[model samples]
Target: MEQSKTNQFNVLAEKPVGSLLMQYAIPAIVAMAASSVYNIIDGIFIGQGVGAEAIMGLALTGPLMSLTAAFGAMVGVGAATLMSVKLGQKDYGTAQKILGNVVIMNLTLGIVLGLLLLVFINPILRFFGASDVTLPYARNFMSIILVGNVVTHMYLGLNALLRSTNRPQKAMCATIGTVVLNCILAPIFIFVLGWGIRGAATATIMAQMIMLTWQLRLFSNKDELIHLNRSIIKLDVKIVKESLLVGLPQFLINLCACLVAAMMTRSLTTYGGDMAVGAFGICNRFILFIVMVVIGLNQGMQPIAGYNFGARRYDRVLGVLNKALIFGSVITLTGFVIGVFFPTPFVSVFAKDSPQLIKMSAHALSCMVMMFPIVGIQIVSTAFFQSIGYAPKSIFLSLTRQLIFLVPAIFILPHLYADPLEGLWHAAPVADGLASVLAITLLVLQVKKFKKQMQAPVENMHTPL
Candidate 1:
């Protein structure tokens, strides 16, 4: 068993960087792409089968969903990053402890956050710009989603551990399975059963619940190096702190995203009404598909970068970062081409009967992705810092686009334009451009520091902020 575990992790340190990236990244990209497809499909079903109001209502739920995901990412991303470093250091015992702590933390946080959101869901939806017509749909969908929040958290957290433990394929399979199941269930519940918006939420939760059960069984196998054990299942204060600390940047990013979504929705609702909100929803789903690909690439890079950095393999770390940035840029640039030049076909899929909705969505989609060619650098740089456990740098980079640059742009830009809606559409690209410039500056400096450190003796070398 020990030999098998050693062989599994040894590849991280020994494999060629290009092949290793392909081996890890392809599965992750497929999984994230599949998940995004499900979201897009869900939007299609709701818009076509229900109404435009329903689509707007769904958009209103984005803020709360982001808020829920924030906590889940905090534990999952943090523990997984930490676990990779521990494995590279050959500290098997600590890695096992991390696996145990992840399960406990996710369960506790999930239940607590779910209940609090459910209790005040009504006011929350209203604050997110849900109107009389849209409020009921949003409320119904979130009620079911919140009730099954623990399932979502456990599924995501366990999947992250699976990737970090040299089982990226298994993690990918789990996500794909859930997405396929949701795709099948959604149509039946929404169209056949006439459950409406509530049905879509139910389908989502049920799929995640089924997959969460499978994930639990996988972790229960004692043969695995990082399997769950009753003895180590108790929470350790130190592990919890480190995990949350490492995960804080992602937490803030998502939390700030929640705030940004709320403000954007409010502005859209005030200026352009419910159809405008629906247009924003359509644009968001499309952009998310492209962004998920970049995130998947980063996920593939995380273990490699973290493991190599822990082993003091500066060259390997630099290699993976460069590859990731290049691939991420290519992916986002493709999105830019498609969104700007040919958005009609994609936007029309959701609301074919509503010509106004399609036109509005197509324009919004183009404006939002105007600077997407450079957006990947910002995302990849933030993830690079996070993977290496440089929490302060990661947190600052994460906040730059969402909180510092985007928030102000969203507020002030609209007032400056003759058409407030046009200003809102342009805010995203402005933030994207400014954030990417900062990312490039920081990355260049970091690379220079790494080069200087490479000249020193290995034993005396230390990671500096």
Candidate 2:
């Protein structure tokens, strides 16, 4: 166990930046890519086997899913960031406390949120602008998903916690396992079982359940440094408070996502109706895939930056941030190029038979990611703050994109343009550009602050006789 801790420290604290990043980021990217693929896989099967309206129903559930993820992030990301810093400080006891808190928090939030949503499912869907044709589909899928919400939360939270403990490979394996299981079950359940949209949702929760079981086993091992303990399982006020503080930024970011999705659906439904809503769903899936790739890079950066910062190794933290920015930018640029130039093929993958939906999605894809190249820097900067425990700064940056800028633009832009649908598509890039600029300014200031801190001399104290 000590050797394991030493190796983690050595790799995170001493390895060459480029090599260490590749080692961590590759697995993360694969895991994130696979996770994103599972989302797409559901869409593909639903669109191919079910109908466009079915996809729209799935789309309506975006806000609900985002809401669930928001709380899960609140627990998972919070605890994970805290754990990384604790590990760096060699406070193994606190790290174990965080692990216990994670399980409890996830279980509590999952049950509460799931039940609340299920109880109010219909009214919520109606408020989100779900038409009569799509309401049943949304309810069907969400009902099953809600039933297994605790499983979903536990899996996601544990995965993040695992990565923070320098178990990125293990985290990657869990997600990949879920993805593979999802792929197998989705087809069988949807097509062979003739269960339709509900089958897709069922497959999803089942896959998560299986992998979460595996994750629990890993944490239950007595040999691990941050393994589960019965005594630690009870809540600790300080651990809970700290975890929530660090996680608030991401929680709010996802909360904003839920709002933004709802707003887009409402606007799209108002102007373009069901097909338009479906088109946005396809576009969202593709965009999420790209974003997840960048997130994978950020995940790789998080532990390194968090640990080094805790250890007062400012140079290492800065090094990882710069490298992460470059790699993330390259990934986003690739996404932009593909989304702008070859969107039809991608959109076609989801809506092969629905030409109108394809056309709308293609246009939405291009417009939404117009500022894609700059986004890597923006996302990385926010993540950097979160990783280093600058929760307030991270929260501010996250809000700049989703709430402060995008929310207003999404509402105002459509009204300004003749074609409201085009305006809706345009709102994203507008927010992206504005938010990226703000992120750049903040990041520059942060870098300067880091430099000042690095140059400051350490205080010396003398003992008096």
Candidate 3:
């Protein structure tokens, strides 16, 4: 398909949204899954080479990393949502203003937050459940991530706009470049140079720099649609407000996930030990990977949903959601089943000589995989709610799995069991199961309402005159 003109309104109007969406989604999904390789590589290299403590060491930074990344994603998703709606409405000038504001906001925010992180990282790590043994490794790793936070922020935040513009392959290429670079450099730094945790962080920064460089090149291309002209390069109050309306729901969701990671860290440390934290860290990484399929659908459908709704094409939105939900269900079945029935193979991929990590990870991964289908439904439903501007519904559905359901379980489950540590391991999966049920119920009701509205008889023009 040829690209549309920068100011064109007929882009989506010319084709079925599903047709355009499929062209974009396959690559977007691949991009996210490829990006997951970065984590998998980091785990394999560090877990095997530096030992289980290395996994715990890096895991120490997971929540804080999540918090910072959540803010970055919030800005990106908010801006992209607004931009897509504007594009759908054929308001090119307003769309440009939004593009400018997103760039300004994310970069400025990234720099400010990065500096603060650099200053207080050690203190934050201790607060996140780091022990004397894990402190050095965590601090070194975090300090490096903070130093390059700006690059990571821009690459991720700006990449959202690429997808919103229906340029999925470009987005995928950007991620591929970074992950490939990271994979190559990680082993060199970790084993060849003997840099340990610091090496992993350094390797990540190296990859991020490559990604950032590629992203900047895209903005500079003169032939591009929606090129960043200097005239519209300032914040617009109206666009910012609208963007926040869509974006804040997702922002809150990510922020809640960060809270979940933090709370998991604190609780795992108390009931289990460094080993449990290590196991939890490994479990969560795989969880994120498994969920990426549903995430791919949510992300791919978000712009399509928002755009279709903006164009008042209500039925198109419903159609997109239908296909996406079915796809998400299939992906959930594949990833979760493998993690459940064949835990040894999956964990063995990231495992080394640590029998403790293997046992603990197998136990944790099996429990976590139990709720996969439900969580898949929750993920897609939350995305649907956010895409359609049901912000409160989105926020509630987003937080329930992690915060409302999981956190409370973490607190109460341990007390009920003879082995409190087993309760600790059960927190996330238990929450996932309950939350999935609630999400499914709400989704079915909402879909029925949409159907009712769609099929409601039009008022007879000349009835009973």
- My TM-score estimates for the predictions, one after another, are 0.99, 0.97, 0.93
Q: RMSD of candidate 1 to the true fold?
A: 1.0
In candidate 3, position 145 carries an lDDT of 87
Score candidate 1 by TM-score against the native. 0.99
User: In candidate 1, residue 111 scores what lDDT?
Assistant: 95
Name the regions of candidate 2 deviating beyond 4 angstroms: 1-7, 459-465
Residue 16 of model 1 has an lDDT of: 91
Worst 10 residues of 3 by lDDT: 456-465
The C-alpha local distance difference test score for the whole of candidate 1 amounts to 0.93
Q: Highest TM-score: which candidate?
A: 1
Query: All candidates' lDDT scores?
Result: 0.93, 0.89, 0.78
Candidate 2: global Cα-lDDT? 0.89
Ranking by lDDT: 1, 2, 3
Each candidate's number of clashing pairs is: 0, 0, 0
Candidate 3 structure quality by residue, lDDT tens digits, 289-398 = 76765676677887787777666666777888887888787788787788788877667656577777789888878877777765677788888887777777788887
Of the two candidates 2 and 3, the one with more favorable lDDT, higher being better, is 2
* 1 or 3, greater by lDDT: 1
The TM-score between candidate 3 and the true structure equals: 0.93
Q: Write the per-residue lDDT of candidate 2 for residues 111-186, one digit (tens) a residue.
A: 9999988999999998888999999999999999999999999999999988888789999999999999999999
* C-alpha lDDT (0 to 100) for residue 84 of candidate 3: 70
